[model samples]
Target: MNNQYILLPASPLFIAFSLIVAFVLNLMPWGQMVGVPDFVALALVFWNIHQPRKVGISVAFMMGLLMDVNEATLLGENALAYTLLSYFAIMIHRRVLWFPLRTQALHVLPLMLLAQAVQLVIQLLVTGKSPDWFYFSESVVSALLWPVVSVLLLAPQRRAVDRDENRPI
Candidate 1:
C-alpha cells in the first residue's frame, strides 16, 4: 500500500473512549469560572484532524447537544458552535497536521475563537445582546490547552516507524 494512503493509526475504541472522557471532563464542576476549557471541543478538533472520516460534523453536533443539555444553556447553542468548529478543523486538518503540536496550537486558536464566536452570535441574536469578552475565555483556555490535548490524545495512537524491508502485505 502507498505510504500516503496508509491508514492513520487510530482505532475506533480509542476515539470513542477519548470522546467519552472529554465529555466527562466538560461536565465536571468548575466553581463558577468565567469560562471553562471545553474538553469536547478539544477532542473533536483532534479526531477531526486525524480521522475526519470516522468522526466529523455529526459527532460534533451530538457532542454539542450533550454539552448544551449538560450545561443547561440554550438548546442548539453549543451544537451550532461545535458544527462550525468541526468544519474549520476539517478544512485545515492536513496543513495543521504537518506542523508540530505546539505550532498547531497557534493554527487552531482562531478556529477555537470562531467556534466561541458562533456561540456568542447565537446568544446575541437570541437575547438581543452581545456577550462580554469573558464569554470568550473558554476559547482562550481551549487554545492554550491544544498542544497538551494533542499530546494526550495522540499518545496511545502513535506508531513506531518500520524502516526495514516491508513485512507481509
Candidate 2:
C-alpha cells in the first residue's frame, strides 16, 4: 500500500462545533417563530457542499429525526426534508463549490425551497391543512445567511501545502 490518504479542508471538531452552534441558533428564542432561520438546515447544506464525503444523507436524516422529536412534528417529516436537502447537496456539490459565495447562495436557495416544500407537502398530507405563506420565510432567511455560515465554518480551515504533513488538520 502507498499509505497515502486525502485530508479534508475543515477539521471534524470545527465541523461538529459549527453544527452545534447552528442547532443553538435554531433553538434561539425568537419572539415570532414565523421567520426564524433554519440554522440547522443551513449548517447541513454548508457541510454537505463543502464536506460531502463526511456529512452524507444519513447524517442529515438523523439530524432531522432529532429535530422532529424535539419539535414534536410528524416523525419522518423533517427526516424526508433533510434527506432531500442532503441528496440535492451531494448532487450539485461540485458545481456549487465552483462559484463565488453570492452565486452559491443563488444556487442553494432552490434547494432550501425544495426542502421546505417537502415539509409543507408532508404537513398538508398529515394535517389536511396548507401552511401559510409565512412558513417559507425561513427558507429566504436561511438563504441569505448562507455566506455568513460559509465564512464562519470555513474560516478555521486551512488547506495543506503538502499532503504528507497533518498538523492544523
Candidate 3:
C-alpha cells in the first residue's frame, strides 16, 4: 500500500489585506483631484490571474459587498459587477494565467472596461443619472496599473542555488 498526503495551498491573507488597503484608499480625501483608480479591482484581477482557486467568485463578491458598505453605495451595485467580473476572470483564468504579462494586460483591460460598464448601467438604473465621466476614467487607470500591481504582489520567487537541492545541471 502507498500512502500520500495531499496538501492545499494556503488561503491568501494578502488578498484580504489588499482589500482593506483598497477601502482605505477609497476613503482618502482626494477631493476631486488626483483621482484614484480601483485598487481593489486591480488587486482582485492580479490575484485571480495568479491564484484563481483561492481568490474566486465568492471572494470577489464578499469584497464587493464590503466596498459597497464602505463607499455607502447601493447594496448590490458593486456586488453584482464584481461577481460578474470574477466569473469572467475564472472562465479565462487558465489562458490568462499562461499569457505573458503584457498580453495578459491586453486581455484584462477590456474586462475591466466591461465591469465598469456593468456598474455604470446599474448606477443609471438605480439613480437615473450618469456619474461623472471621471468615474469611468478609473477603469483605464486601473487597467494600466494591473501589470505593476501583479509584479508587486505576485512575482515569482527566485530560489537561491542553495535552496534548490534537487536542481539538475
Candidate 4:
C-alpha cells in the first residue's frame, strides 16, 4: 500500500471541532494591551499546509467569513485575507512540506505577517484609521505557535508511524 495514496476520511466532525475550538479561543477575554493570538488562522494554516486538498481556498474563505462575523469586523476583511493566505499556502505547499519544521516555520512567518497586514489594511480602509500595532502582534504569536500547532495536529500520524515501526516488518 502506498502510504501517500491512502485515503483518509475527510471528517466533517473534525472540521467543525476545529472551527469551534477556534471560535472559542477567539472569544476568550484577553487584555487590550495584550492581543489574543489568531487561533483560527493558526488552525487553518496548519490544516492547509498538511491537507491542502481538503482544506483549500474555499474552506479558508468560509472560515474567514465566520471569523469576520465572530469578531464583528468588516464583512469581507478576514475573508479576503484568508483567501489570499490560502492561495499563498497552496502555492508553496510542495516546497514548504519538504522543509524541516523550523524551516517551515520561517517560511510561514511571512505569510502570517502578510495575512495580518491585509486584514489591518482592510480595517483601516473601513474605519479611516489603523488599529493599534498591538493587534498585529497576534501574527508574531501565531508564527511562534505554528510548530506547536503542527505537532499537535500531526500527533495521530506520528503515532501511526510508531505503531508501524513496532509491527513486524
RMSD of each: 4.6, 6.1, 6.5, 4.0
Better candidate number, 2 or 4, judged by lDDT: 2
Question: Candidate 3: which pairs clash?
Answer: none
lDDT of candidate 1 over 62-140, digit per residue (tens) = 9999999998889999999999999999999999988876788888889888988888788778888876658778878
Query: lDDT of model 4 at residue 132?
Result: 66
lDDT of 3: 0.74
lDDT of 2 at 106: 90
In candidate 1, the residue pairs with backbone N, CA or C atoms under 3 Å apart (3 or more residues apart, or in different chains) clash, namely none
lDDT, candidate 3, 55-98, per-residue tens: 88888899889889977889977888888888887788889866
The count of backbone overlaps in candidate 3 is 0
After TM-score superposition, the amount by which residue 80's alpha carbon in candidate 1 deviates from its true location, in angstroms, is 0.9
User: lDDT for model 2, on a 0 to 1 scale?
Assistant: 0.84
* 110 Cα displacement, candidate 4 (Å): 0.8
List the candidates ranked by lDDT, beginning with the highest. 1, 2, 4, 3
Off by over 4 Å in 4: 1-12, 33-35, 161-169
Which structure is stronger by lDDT: 1 or 2?
1
**What would the TM-scores of all predictions be?**
0.84, 0.85, 0.81, 0.84
Evaluate residue 160 in candidate 1 and report its C-alpha lDDT on the 0 to 100 scale: 45
Q: What local distance difference test score does each model get?
A: 0.85, 0.84, 0.74, 0.78
